[model samples]
Target: MKNARLATATVLTAVLATGVMADAGAQPTSLMDGVYTAEQAATGKALFEQNCSTCHNADYYKTVLQTWRGQPLMYLFEQVMSAMPADKPGALMDTEYEDVFAYVLQIVGFPAGETRLQYAGGSMEDIAIQPAP
Candidate 1:
């Protein structure tokens, strides 16, 4: 039984070590890092105006942005993408959802870049939002 326990422990250690190495090697996309291009932010703005402005106004960010400033855009993206328009959750397309995130980033004063912000394959904790450049 001692041998069995030792084998199990060794296997567990290998799995844990692999997981750590994978996480360390991975590079997460940041929401504040020019992920979305200016065009995308503009497009996202229009979508937000049409779909979200009714309930949430400019002041909403004054409170929420502070807490979310350094977080990944995807974090904010997922929450809004999953449940927004309060009246019509999950109503927007994935592209539209990403666009909306761009708009929110713009509103929070993050600078617009040349690339569009992707909705998946990134974490929010990796980015830091800064005032527009």
Candidate 2:
């Protein structure tokens, strides 16, 4: 009976350890994945038109894409999210920022997939943004 109890305890411990490991390795939920619906992107486009179109256009990032340096999407998003509009930097809400991001993505011709591009924390040097197909 003691041996059977010991085996059961060992099995339970192994199972618990496995579960912990799996959770640790799990990927964080991306911001782009279903965070904004198609309608939200349209709203964001309109907002940009009313608020930011004077200073910047949809092709603002075309040069960046051609250069291919710095954080492709996330880098641009962070900069805009942190300090943009020139007139009112750091004023837009998070959801507004996300909407603008979606609009920018749309302009860039990156077809909106089911996954919204989440900002992955890391060095931008290694991250490669492939040209839109």
Candidate 3:
């Protein structure tokens, strides 16, 4: 009985450890993980220049990104979606806004990734806005 109990405890510990590691691997800890693609960033750049450049620039974003460090990227996305272009807030499609965000990330020196950034299903919330490394 003693040997059986020890085996059971060891198995349980392994299961728990696997679960914890899986959870940790499932979520991204920072933007430097290459969350957006180069193509997406390019699209974002055009959109930003056409819609957001007159009011905001790379320097402006440097300050804003600093203040937003350690926060989720979603918060900034929502802010831009609701209060951008200095005239038409939420005027662009959701994907367009995401593309614009990718541009911002590129300008701020985040590495582009194979995957494009997405706002749906809490992915953005999972990605934290970290300072350029």
Tell me the whole-model lDDT of each prediction, alpha carbons only: 0.68, 0.58, 0.81
Candidate 1 segments whose C-alpha is farther than 4 A from its true place: 1-32, 123-125, 128-133
The sequence of per-residue lDDT tens digits that candidate 3 reaches over residues 1-133 is: 9999999987886676446435545554578888999999999988988999988788788889777665667878898888886699888999999899889889988899988899887677667676665
Best by TM-score: 3
**Two-way TM-score contest, 2 vs 3, winner:** 3
**In candidate 2, what residue range of length 10 has the lowest lDDT sum?**
123-132
**TM-score of model 3 vs. true structure:** 0.77
Model 1 / residue 30 / CA error / Å: 5.6
Output the TM-score of candidate 2: 0.57
Q: Which of the predicted structures, 1 or 2, would earn the higher TM-score when compared with the native?
A: 1
**lDDT tens string, model 1, 9-85?**
87886676446436545454444567677888888888998999988876676566655444444556678777798
Per-prediction TM-score to the true structure, in the order listed: 0.66, 0.57, 0.77
Off by more than 4 A, model 2: 1-37, 68-72, 117-133
Error of 1 at 133 (Å): 9.1
Question: Model 3's lDDT to the true fold?
Answer: 0.81
Residue pairs in steric clash, candidate 2? 32-116, 32-117, 33-116
Residue 40's lDDT within candidate 3 is 95
Best candidate according to lDDT? 3
